[model samples]
Target: MEIETRTPAEQLRACEALRRTAEARSLDILCELAEHYEVSEDSLIEHLVDRRIQPVVPGPTVSEFLSLELAGLLECTPLQAAAKLYSALRLKYRHPTLHTAVQQLDIEPHRALRAVDKCAHLDASVAERVTTGWLPQQLGLGHTAALNRLDKLVVEADPQRAIERERARRKDLDVSLWGSYDGVTTLSGRLEDLDARYLDASVDRMADVLTAEHPGLSRGQLRAKAMGVLANPAMALGLLQRAAQPALPDSEAPNGCLGPLCGTIQTPLHKLRPRLELAVHIDTNAVGCATGSARIEGAGHITLNLLREYLSDIDVTVQPVIDLATVAPEDQYRPSAALKKVLLLAFPTEMFPFSNRATARFMDFDHTERFRSGRRRQTRLGNLCPFSRRPHRGKTAGVWDVKQHSVGVLTWTSPLKYVYEVSPGGTRLVDTGHDAWRKLDW
Candidate 1:
């Protein structure tokens, strides 16, 4: 299977020889060579014929071939190997029709993988029905809708089994906040409906008050503050007050006062009142649907029920996420609010792609608009264009086409037309993993 290789100079000479113009003179020489070799012109061009038949040996299954490719292409890249391995597994088990849906329906591979995961536990009929019936139709329904439809189909096929499975899932419920590390405490476990609702309300109420007083808190900080307040609002306030005051002398220090130099002192940063202005995109249609799924900025699944319960005490402003469009010269200032919210939501990390560092709140808004200069049409996003501006730019500087993804939760995403990603730096951008958002090199 090994093919001989040639040096660049040798390849160049070969290319020049082969590319000698196939005009009459060139053709005459080629014809003479063919005759001397006892071969016809058709035989000389036989390699170009399209193969309607499968290869004689059929090389290998996609999974096997990809494995070999991965070994060769990613010899030292563990991360890529792990990622591709998952894809290979999916490819191995993926039904032929699912592959067709991916090609014809334009479903992204990751999304198709999700659909595959759903039906993985069920019968082939379930996956087939979804791939054939719902996936192909771009009926303005986002991926959530298609998934929901598939779930409904699953239930209709076997209700008792679905209910039993759901009940079993409900049993895995517990609440825990592990010991703190680096001033961060991990919270896990599930809650009952009433408990979850109460917790959300408590956090929201505290977050509203905190955000109002301190307007610059990012969503994570706001949430942490809210939860801290919920744990013991009175004690939390007292601690804040103590931290705000200057440190006392060694002996004069209060009984519990660790003072300004305390390793964990975070009152100053908290007092600044960081904003929790996260942009959550959700499909409006999926919000209340039985099988609808929502994500809080890409922080895993946040069902509408949970989102409503969690944000009950927090003020929310709903706005349309217009499509990417060119800003007309006539419109004066940019219509900033909506676009800024969308960009921040999409790029929560506020990262400068070049620096590979998180902005933490210092990043500015950049508009990489479509079609300018001497190039073909390009994406209208920050990464591609060398356009960076302060956080709050003109209201509508680069709006060309306004597309509205359905929902607006914390880190909202349209699983179909667009995919949102949360970077290691905590920025939420479109999942540029696939060819979907080539503007971002991620």
Candidate 2:
């Protein structure tokens, strides 16, 4: 039981056992709850297989209220609870062999669930046949290999459906901006094949042009700069025209010429300007310091040198700094802009257990203690914390018991008596020797 004495391999085996046990326990509970409701047995209908009558694969359909009740206990939104319940039911009944393997700690539950997900659209009879036939061999394969095998089985079972799924997936294209970290934002998405190739070629072309001028920059760094260069239509068009000409040797290329045609292109660079709003909060003393850090609104922490590099050419509109010490508690329920800004600076992400790391700026500033109409200073910094809409609704519905023990420290007690401590640092499960969350035997 002493983790310090255990070898790394032993620790990993212990962790694997605990993870399987937890998932098995969760499936048991979900199946029990699903049985409480009047589950439809349509998919459970008996069918003739190899001259014997057998029950087809089945899954439960629980009442909507059950999901709401489980949401608070699970510390997740109702939609997530329902999805988990649905997946658990399918895993338990539709793939009984895999389910038993999970319960016996022979295989990971996620791998089995991945099989269930891949074959979910097939008919109950087909799904049962596929899993029952392939479960024995695929159980020992690695995660990715197992999933690939399952996908092949699904394609073999229902080729028409697989074709349809492929066509549908190909049509799903989108571009999105994810969170910023270490002074860089991530842009990711799925794109059509031809468009992706075109974009890739364009980026390489731009990166090549940038590399001719900035020899110190690496290829990856030049490619990143190429994305920004492509954003400007004037610069993009000029680069395209220059690309039509013959290639310049590395030695013959003009150094320090970032603009198109070695700064000879006459097109005005500012004709189509890209506007961006970036909010950066810094301490007064750190403004001109040699070594200090600042917090970008969407991005996390950034060093002063990196911040200067990011804002070197961009126009910055500075706002007067508010003295957080002087900002007093307000009598109104709604918090002021300054107070909200202070809270965003304090807590960068929403203050809910198992939250999706939602930015604090987009969350609802809810009072930890309910606001009374006539109470003075009810909506204050100490009493307010940001929560996403679903978590806020769950709290409002009295499903969870939330107690703010001190400023920036809160404890949440679920209906099932699962305790979680939430603070500015992070969230952690509180072990209170409760039966529900007792220490597992590893």
Candidate 3:
């Protein structure tokens, strides 16, 4: 245990191993806590129902509160204790795969517990599928991937409910501004796509004009200024008019034209419209069916009928499908725009394990096995995966290693020697704990 003279790499490995051990032990404690807090079958329901009695049921049960004993034992807030109890009970009784994985110290405790919490609203069968089927596949990925996958599963399980929720959400739409002591205010709200698009265009137009006035400001700063300008409709309108004015020769006019806003003063801000390019993936069986679900680009999943209703008011152009299986990989190192689009569509999210901050479209298409120049057929579908900048750097720096098993399927090894497999279907923790640690020495 004495590490005063140990190398930095050795110290890092020791710390990582200890951390994994601590996390595994923590899960064991939570399971024990759940057993301790479980409602006794012998206890009468009438006793708990009494108005004078404080609710003793653990977890997020509507009327029940965490028991004082449980909170005291955990040395945490009642809410925190309750949440812990909830995750433990759900994992042990319901999500067996997650339960075993955590017990074996394969997956992170927080990640597994959060998965339980996200699936709290699901029914028995669907929730079972989530833990036993879908979760095991996505376990290698980060929390955000798990969250997004959970949402997709929930929508697919009950598309009608998702549609209803979307409808109810629309009814709750409201815009509000919060003022802060930092001399700045935050404006945020959800709006219908049509209205939001128009507003976005107006803001961009105004931002363009503001750019001329504030030459040193970033585009984002200019946009923020534009939002303030829009608060005064008359001033905003006059500025838009001036911005739209055609520029005369430099000799005739003192100032040149505004950037994108220069031209056609006749096209008022109100007349501006937004064009959207939307792609929706639908299951073959669910085509033209109310029960089927469709996943929209950027958005998760929705019922087929919900998608129809959403597009009803808009002008939609249908494009022929490009069969990904048939799309052959090009020989060149740099993929063509058309091929890049296919790749992005093929893997919508970044390929790195424990990463979901960026979509594939915003990521670099990394060669799974380092691409060598003049190598024939090196830049192929199975050999390529999307990687974010940080992970890409790590991979290049030899801090992390990757092996592509097949198209969209990859296995990665961390500096700590923990192994994870990631694919479009989900992710899996291939190796971990003391066994993996011991093997490193062997």
TM-score against truth, every candidate: 0.32, 0.72, 0.42
Question: Which candidate has the top score in TM-score?
Answer: 2
258-309, model 2: which lDDT tens digit per residue?
A: 3345544665554445666666878889977989999877777899999888
Candidate 1 lDDT, 30-148, residue by residue in tens: 22322232112232233332112211111122211222123222332223443445433443344456655444435555566566566555555554665556565634667787678
- Runs in model 3 lying further than 4 Å from the true structure: 1-6, 17-93, 139-152, 172-182, 185-189, 232-235, 241-442
Question: Which regions of candidate 1 fall more than 4 Å away from where they truly are?
Answer: 1-94, 103-106, 137-140, 172-192, 208-223, 230-442
Ranking by TM-score: 2, 3, 1
Task: Provide C-alpha RMSD values for all models, in order.
Answer: 24.7, 9.1, 24.9
Record all residue pairs in model 2 with backbone atoms less than 3 Å apart, i.e. clashing.
none
- For residues 1-442, write the lDDT of model 3, one tens digit per residue: 3566567879898898788777767656665644443322333243333112212222323213222224334544344555666667677666767778877877777777777776666665567676676666676777788778877877887788778777877778789764322235578998987889999998998899888789999989999999977876756866876765655554343245555544344445433335557777787788766687777765666777777787776567788886767877778888889888878777877776544433656688988888888788887789888876656655665555789988988987654456777877665677753453343320
Highest lDDT scorer? 2
lDDT of each: 0.44, 0.72, 0.67
